[model samples]
Target: MSVISEEHVRGGSVFKDISADDDDWQPTEIESLCMNCYKNGTTRLLLTKIPFFKEIILSSFSCANCGWTNTEIQSAGRIQEQGVCYTLKVKTKEDLNREVVKADSATTRIPELDFEIPAFTQKGSLSTIEGLLDRAVAGLEQDQVVRRATHPEVAVKIEEFIQKLRKLKEVENEFTLVIEDPSGNSFVENPVAPQKDEALTVAFFKRTVQQDIQLGIKADDDLDEEPAGNDLETMRNEVLTFNTNCPECNAPASTNMKLVQIPHFKEVIIMATNCDSCGHRTNEVKSGGATEALGTKITLHITDPSDMTRDLLKSETCAVIIPELEFELGMAALGGKFTTLEGLLKDIKDLTVSKNPFICGDSSTADRIQKLREFGEKIDKIIVGELDVHVILDDPAGNSYLQNVYAPEPDPEMTVEKYARSFQQNEELGLNDMKTENYEEKNNVPAVPGGTE
Candidate 1:
C-alpha cells in the first residue's frame, strides 16, 4: 500500500473490449434520458457472461439529438467475501499498457508521485495505466482557467505538478500503481496471467467496519427509530431488520438476522436478504458463539436416499472432501452454509460446474468443461443414492455440525472426532496472535504480524 499524500480526481473511463461474449445472448434496446443532450436516447444493454468469470452488463448510450454517446461496464457478480489490493510496478512501456478495471469503490495511488485517488471520488473505469494517467491529466487541466484567475499562487503549484505528471507519461522513470478496493472489484491486467506477472502483486484482506458501512453492507447509523427498536436487544428470537443496500443491484434493501438454536447444537445467527429491485434473495448461516478449544471432523457414510434430507452446517472454516469422488474443497470455499445434504450436493454441483467463474476468458479448455459437467453428474448420483460416498467435513473452529438422523442413538454411519488445531491453522485464524490469558497486564499494545493488537 502506498502512503497517502495528495489525491487527484478524474472523470469516468470507458473501455470497449469484451473478453468473450455468450453466443446465444441478445442485447436489449431501450429508450432512456440522455445525460449529455437532456433528450431521450437509445440505450443498448447486454448482459455478458465471461467463460470463467462473473457476468457483467455492457451498456452503450447514443443520443440522436446531440450525437452524444457513452459506454460503461457494470459487474453483475456478487460481492466477494474479502477485499483485494493490486500493486503494479509500472517499470516498462508494456506495464503501462496493461488493462485495468477501477471500481468506483476502489482507491488508486501513484506511490512514486505520492498521489492518490480516493474511492467514489471518481466513477468506475475499464482502462489501462496510461489511460488512467491521461484521464488524471485531463481532469486537472479542466479547472486551470478558473484556478489561474482566482488563485494564481495555488494555480502555479498545480501547473508545476501537472508538468511533472506529464513527464511520467514518457516512462522515463519507474513507479508503482496501487489500487486498494474494499469491494474486491478492481483489476490490473496481466497479459500472461496464471503464469505470474513479476511486475504485479495481488492480495486479499478483510474489510474494515468503516468500509462495510460505506459499501451499504451495514447501517452507518442506528436504524431503529421505531417501536421494534428494542426487539433485537431484548429478544433473541425476534428478527432484527436493518436497512442496507442490495449486494446484487446496490439498491435500498433490508437484511434480517435472527438468533436460533439447533436441537442438540449451539445457537447460530441466520441472516437473509431480499432485494426488491432484482428479486434476488440470499441467506447465510454463521456461528454465534466463541471459538471452541479444539477443531472438529465429521464423516458421514451416505448409502440411502433419505440421507439427502439430513441437515448440514458447513462453517466458514470448514473443508469438505468426498474420497469416493476424489473431490476436495478447501476452507472458505463454500462459505458458511446451512442447508440439507441434497441442497449441499446441489450447491457443490452448481459451483463446480455452472458457477466456477475462473475460466480466464479464452483459455478455458473443452476437457475442463467436460470434467466439471461429469463432476456435477456424479453429485446428482450421490443425491439419488446411486453411489455410496463418505463426505468429510473438517472445521478448524469446531463450529460445523451435521444432523444425525438417528440422533441420540448415535447414527452408525456417522463419526465425529475432536482434535487440537495445528499451528498453521491457528495462525490462519489469528488465534496465534491473540493474547487470551491476560490482556489487562499489557501497557501500550504492540501490533501483531498481519493484525493490530
Candidate 2:
C-alpha cells in the first residue's frame, strides 16, 4: 500500500457539511493530520455518539509531564468553532432558532450519561456495600426473593440499592472506607482494611430479581399471558417448498442435489435430467459457454514485435509453417541443464519458417542467440541484452499459441510431471508433423519406411 499524503485534508472540508462519514471510513493520511491538528495536544477527542451527520467528539487529553487531564466536548463536523458551541440552552425563540442553524445536523446522538459521584460526598467502601448486599440476599432464594421484591415497598429498597451500585460502577480509584452508625458505634470489627474499587456487580445483583419472581407477580396481577406458539421451522419449510420448482419444465426440483454456483451469474441448475417420452438427457441451466460471468480460460502470447521471419515464410517462401516444435528441457533444480545453444539453434532451424520460438537461457544468452539467429537467415528475437526470449507464436488465422512463462526460479515449486504436462499443452508445437509432396527432399529427411500410406 502507498503512504497517505497531505492532499486528503484539503478535500475533507467538502464533506464537512455532509452527514458524518461511516465509522469504518478509514481516514486518509491528510485527514488524520487534520484531526491531529484539531486536537491541539491538551485534550483528546473520542468519537462516541453522533446525531445524524454530526459526530459527538469527546476530547480528553492528559499531560504525562504534569499529570494533568483536560476534557472538552465538541460537535463533530469540520472542526469549526461555531459548529461546536451550541450545547448551551437558549433562552428565547430567536436564540433557539439561531443556535439550531449552527448545530451540526450530522451530530450523532450522545449516549445517556450515567449518574456522576459528587466529589464532596462521604466515601463508601465498595467491599462493604458488596458484602452487605450479599448478606441481605444470602438466605433468600433468588427466584423467590425477586418475586417478593415485586411488592411496592421492597421494590423501592432494591431500586435504591441499584442506584448505589450504578454510582459504584463509576468510581475510578481504589480506596478503603470505615462506616459508623449515627449512635457513634463503628460498623466493622476491623477499622483498617485493604480494598480495590471495582465495577458494581449489577448484573449479578440483577439476577437476584428473577424472571420467575416477575412471572409470579405478573400472574398474580392477571397480567401474564401465554406466549405465542412458535412454528418457525414449519413455516420456513412451507415457504421453501412453495419455491421449489423448475422454471423450464415446471417439474418438482430436488433439494437434495447441490448446485454449482458460478460468480456474477444467476440460474439454478439441475444436473442430468432425463425426459421420459423424448428420451432426451439435458441439463437444467442454459449452456452459457462463453458468458462473462463464467470465468474464461485466457490464452496469452508473448512475443517480440520486431520478428518478421515468420511473415516472410507465409508470403514468399514455399515452406509451409510448422507451428508445433517440441523441445523439452529437463527441470532446473535437479542439476539438469535447461537448454543448450546447439539444441536451441537446431530446434529453431527445424521449424517450418512460420512458428514462433521460445528461447530460454542463462544471463549471457544474447551472444549465443545471435549466432543461432544467423543460421536461419531470419529475424527471430531481439537481443535486448537479456538471457530469455518469450515470443508469440500464431497461425495466419491469428490463433495465438504461446502463452507466458515466468522468469526461471532457482527452485520452482512445481512437480516435474506438471511442468512436462504444461509444456505439452502450452509451449511445444509439432512442426515436423506437416506434409508436402516434395518437402522431404527439401528438408533432407529420410523417406518413411511404410511408404505414403
Candidate 3:
C-alpha cells in the first residue's frame, strides 16, 4: 500500500563523503560577510550526490575574526513522492555513533523524555548520533547566558533540562529517537547496510496541508473555499477550480467544482479531483444552501438487499448511527458525501479500518487494529443486508437526505422527522448567533468609526 520507492541504502562504510566534488573533492569557495562579526569570511558550497541518495548542497561558512562557523545541508533534488519518518532505538552507548542525515524541515523527538526539536529550529545536518546530541546541547546552552541575567528560575530549569539531554549521549537507559521529515529527504544510518538494521525502522506517510505548504509543494492559499451562498442560477454553469495537494501524495492538484442538483433537493456543489502526479481520483460534495430552521432525523430499516442501492446524502454536519451494530459515528468523522447505501458502508469501513491512522503497523497497536477490522466486518454484513439494522441520519443542518425508493408513496420502513434544534445544536451550527432581521436597534450595535452610510 505504500507508494514510496525505496532509496539506495548505504552500509559498512559510514558515508561516501557526500560533500566531496567529483574531481577536486573540494567545495566551491566564495568570500562573504560574516553576520557574527561583520568581518570578511569564507563560504564553501558543495554540489554532490550521495550514493543511493539524491543530489544535495552542503555549505560551510567560517569567519576567522570571531571564529564563528556554520554548516548546513540542502536538497538539490525534487521533493520525494512521500514523507518519511525514521525511528531508532538507542539501547547501548555505541548506538550513539549511528550517522544521521537530517533535513531542516525534519522534526526530532525522544518519546522517553517527551522532548522535541521542532522543524526549522536549526539547520539541516549530516552528522552522527553523538553529534546530533551535541547540537541539541549547544542549542540549549546558546540562550542560557541571556536567560540567567533576566530570569533565574526559568534558566535554572533549562540548565536541568540541558543536563538531562547531555545524559542521552551516555545511553544509560534504552530510548527511542524519532525523526519525521515531510519532505522525505532525511536518513538514519543502517550499520548493517544492504542488510536491515534491527534498531532502525522507516515509515512513509502522506503530508498534511501545513506540511505541503512548508515544503513548497503547494501554496498556502491554494486550497480556496467556494464562494459562499451563491445561487444556482448565478454559478451553476461555472466550473470553479482551486489548487489542492493530492490526498495520496501531497503533490499539487486541482479540484474542479460545479453546482449539481439532486431530485427534490436543493443545489449542492460537487468537486472532483484527479491528481496527475499520483493518479489519485477523488470527489467531495457540499450543500450549497443555508441551514434550515429545524433539524431532520431520518431512520431507514434495512429490510432487503435492494436497499443497498438507496441514494444517501450525508452532509458535513451529519452523524450516522447503526443500532444493530451499536455503532454511532460522530459528526465531521466522514466528510460531506453523496453516495449509494453500499458506498456509504464501504466509506465507513475504510474510515475505521484502512484509513485509520492507528491501523496496525506494530505490536503495540494490534489489538486496537483488530477491533477496527471486526467493526469493518460488521459493516460488510450490513452492506450485504445480512444483518437487521436501522440506519439513522441526524443532521442539525437539515441538509441530509436518504432516497425514498417508494417515491410519492410513503416507504413503510422509513420515517422522516423534524424537530426544533436544542440550544447546544444551535450553537454548534452557529444559528444561535445568526442575525438576519436585526435592525441595528434590536442589539444597539455600534458603528465603525469611519463607517459609510
Candidate 4:
C-alpha cells in the first residue's frame, strides 16, 4: 500500500463496501500497472480488525510477466489524537504470560536491558510479553550495528546486553516492560486487580507536533479519545441490580450486583446487600462465567521475606488450607480477597485475635488462645524468612492463582497441580448434577480453565 501524504485524506477516507465473508475472509483484488516492471499485475488487499487496536490494511502486488512482488501494511482507521504508553512489571514467570499488542509504529524499551526497538522495523504483532522480548533479542542479534562494532570492549558490552535479554525469560530475573505507541494502537493486557494495584500502569499523553509529523500523523486527528474511564463506567452500568428480602428483618433490601473480572480466572458476580431496618449487611459472591470441570491446587513454601510481597488473587470458591498449622479456611470463611501473602496472613491472625475474648474467661481456652498467639508469631517469622511454612490453595472452580516470579527457572519451593474434582467437590459445586455431554449440543462451553490449563 502506498503511504497517503495528505493527513485529512489518510484519516477521513474509508474503503468502499469492504466487508468480511462468512469465514471472515474478504479480499479486494485489482489489476494495476507495476512500478518496477511496467507490466500489469494483480494487487490484492485484505482488511482485518486487530483486537485492542484499529483495523489494518494488508496489501500484496505481484506481476506475472516480470516476476515483481511487493507487500505492505497500513492503518485503515483514522489517526489517534493521543499516544499510549503501557508499563508492566515483570516480577515473575506468570507476568510473562500477559498478552501484548504492539503496533508497527510503537517503540519498545527495556531500560534495565539498556535496549530499545525503534518503530517500523518490524510489523505489528499480537504476542505474549515473553515473545516480545524474544523478538527484541533476535533483532539485536542480527543488527549490523552490533556486528560492525570496531572496539572489542563495545562488542563485549553488546553481547552482555543480549545475554541480559535472554536472561529475562528466566523466572529469577525481574525487569520492566515498556511500550509507547504514537498511533495509540498498542496495549498490554492488565492483570485484573483493584484500582490501586501497581502491577500494570497505562498512560495516555498528547503527542507533540513534531512527533506527529515524524510519524506521518496529523495534529488535528479527532478519531482517538481516551476510553478508559468510559469503559469502566460502561462495565459498571451492565451490573445486575435488584431487591431481595432480608432474612433477619423480613424487610425489602436492595442488592447491588457487579461483575468482577479476575485475571487468568473466570468472572464472578458480587452481590452485596444491606438491611436498613435491622442494620444488617451481607455480601455473596457467585461465579458468573463458566466453571472448570477439573480442580486446581497451588502450593508455595514461604522461603524468603520477599515472597510475602508476591500478589495473590483468591476466588471465593477456593479454600486456603495450612497443613502445617492444622488450620483450614473454607470458602465461607473468607470472600474473594486480592492481597499479598503477608496481607493474607495478617488478616487471618486478626481474625483469630477477634475471638480471643471468649477464650480469656476459661483456663483451658486461655491456653489455646496463647497457642494461637504463638502461631501468629510463627507466621510473622515466616513472613520475615525466619521460618518456612507451606501455603496451599485448593479451588474446585480453578479460579485461584499464585504469582510466579521466577518462571522458566524452576522454583523448588512451589508447585501447581490440576486434578479431576472429587465426587464431593463436584456435588458441592453442583457440577455433578449438570451433564457435560450436552455442552457441545448446547453450544455453551466455559472459557479455558485457569491454573496450569
The candidates, ranked best first by TM-score, are 1, 3, 4, 2
Q: What TM-score do all the candidates reach, one by one?
A: 0.59, 0.13, 0.53, 0.38
Tens-digit per-residue lDDT, 1-453, candidate 2: 122234533433212222256433232221121232343233443443322223334445554444545444443333211111112221222221111111212121111333222211321221233343232343233345565656766766655655554443334423222221111111121111011112111000011123323222224335456977847545333422122333222244433222333333222222344443224333222222222211122112224332222211110001112212222211110111112223233344543122212122111146434543453443233222122333222222111111113324321221111112223322222222435568788889888988977
What CA RMSD would you report for each candidate? 11.4, 33.3, 12.6, 25.0
Q: Rank the candidates by lDDT, best first.
A: 3, 1, 4, 2
The reply for model 3, stretches above 4 Å from the true place, is 1-234, 237-245, 437-439, 442-453
Error of 3 at 336 (Å): 0.7
Model 2: worst 10 consecutive residues (lDDT sum): 199-208
Under the 3 Å rule for N, CA and C atoms, how many clashes does model 2 have? 20
Segments of candidate 1 deviating more than 4 angstroms: 1-81, 84-181, 186-205, 209-233, 358-363, 444-453
Global lDDT for candidate 2? 0.28
lDDT values for all models: 0.77, 0.28, 0.78, 0.70
lDDT of 3 by residue, 1-453 (tens): 111112212222112354324343445688999999999999988655553234677788999899999888887666765687889999998788776888899999999888999998888888888888889988889889999999999999999998989988878888999999998888776544222357887665668889999988789798956867866576777888899777544568999999988887788888899988658888777898988888999999999989999988999788888876667665555668888989888888876667543343321155555666777878888878788899999998999999999888899999999999999788766677777774565878875578657
Task: Pick the TM-score winner.
Answer: 1
Supply every candidate's count of residue pairs whose N, Cα or C atoms clash at under 3 angstroms.
3, 20, 0, 3
Task: Please give the distance, in angstroms, between residue 403's alpha carbon in candidate 2 and its true position after superposition.
Answer: 70
User: Whose lDDT is higher: candidate 3's or candidate 4's?
Assistant: 3
